[model samples]
Target: CQELPLIPEQDSRDIEVVCNLYESLLTLQRQGINGIWARIIKNAFAPLFNKEFDYVAGNPPWVNWESLPENYRQDTKPLWQEHGLFPHGGMDTILGKGKKDISMLMTYVAMDKYLKKGGKLGFLITQSVFKTAGAGQGFRRFRLGSGEHIQVQHVDDMVELQPFEGASNRTSVV
Candidate 1:
């Protein structure tokens, strides 16, 4: 029952499986048949297995709106409204108003919908999650055994900062 927020990179029209399949085909052509087939199989089966581990972790993407395609912007607009997070020109633009990581929001959504009662979720979020006004407050309220309850254990700064500077900054835990 793990629910994840879908963020469109371009238009909502580009968010379909058809586009993904086409992307896959293009990728496979470039990587050769074997590499492509392996990816296909992996994608097909990866969602069916539940991997058990003590902790769930990862850094989420930090892409803002300007970096996203127009379709994605339109698609996410309602999500921002529904969550009461202001919608701006693009994701990065919204950052100016102090929004938290989409990954942190997604992590909470997953726990609310998927994690069994008493199951724990530990995610690394941006400083914004702890410091922002509206978004952070909303997150805290949700964790305070409020609506659809989830709990927070601990939050720590990344002692090492190098992992945050690469092309995959979004991979940061949030």
Candidate 2:
């Protein structure tokens, strides 16, 4: 058996590489490991907005509002309100649970507040972003330029996973 080098031990400074490492760590943590690096970085940088990222990639956690941790749920309320995704009672309903898709909302927030005009954003998002009434309307109404809006590129179907493998029946890379 051969030993695989740890990600942090690698020398490349590519942001995509860093984000990939973060995603892997996050996946491991969700599986019950003590991986805390990604959460730490996200928390530290959540408040700091960057002009743009050269490369962004990940299968964002699809946790619904009801499943979100208290702190994050509280912190993200304003974003939900600003984006018009907040439900009544400030809580998620069974049908609405996970349906709000904070990942998509966060992506919009990042692009609106951080990405430079004409800058590109590459991320994996649920197909609902393209089909959901609210999200679809929002995307259609989104303005990237004076009279322009965001566009979608190469799309792919869902991959199988546990705990809800096919729950994302319409998953796509957008």
Candidate 3:
């Protein structure tokens, strides 16, 4: 058997499950986290709940801010500011540069709220996040406050491979 990191304080309730409940449960079991129905809420919804993890992984949906539901956009505005995902200048907004993918926020939240110091986060997301000058500018800053920096260790570009069926958007694992 493989040795799993001992999460003494992390229990079944600590595993946040947004979708794919069955799959998440099975993965939790395989990772040595007891699966439970309690605390089955989106991490975005529970901003106060903070539990650190040695590693975090996810494929956050790649929806732009303008495409998100109006209510969701309003509800998460504070969170965006809290994590500094939004730029400070109103010029970015006027130039259409303020638009950002929801996945960027997910990445920031995962690292800021859930990841331990020096922990690793891997996410399958739109490759434009690195190249786009509009919405991705904020993400490229790579700063998490107080001089903390997100050092990207590696990137696997899957754009040419077209791994997703019927989807043409450029993708990458970072």
Specify the highest-TM-score model's number: 3
How many steric clashes between backbone atoms does each model show?
18, 0, 0
Q: Report lDDT per candidate.
A: 0.52, 0.58, 0.77
How do the candidates rank by TM-score, highest first?
Answer: 3, 2, 1
- How high is the lDDT of residue 33 in model 2? 58
TM-score, structure 2 vs. true: 0.54
Better candidate number, 2 or 3, judged by TM-score: 3
Give per-residue CA lDDT, model 1, range 1-174, as digits (tens).
012245566645535655666677777788765323534755665675445444455544455534555565575555544553442336644556444456544555456444667766666556655666555565555552224544556666663664556633322243
lDDT (C-alpha) at residue 135 in model 3: 74
Better of 1 and 2 by TM-score: 2
Tens digit per residue, CA lDDT, model 3, 1-174: 112343536733443232345566667778865423223446434666457889999998898888876767887888787667787458768787887899998898788888899999999989988988877877888877444899999989998898798997899999
Which parts of model 3 are misplaced by more than 4 Å? 1-40, 43-50, 88-91, 145-147
For each candidate in turn, the TM-score is: 0.50, 0.54, 0.69
Q: Would you give me the overall lDDT of model 2?
A: 0.58
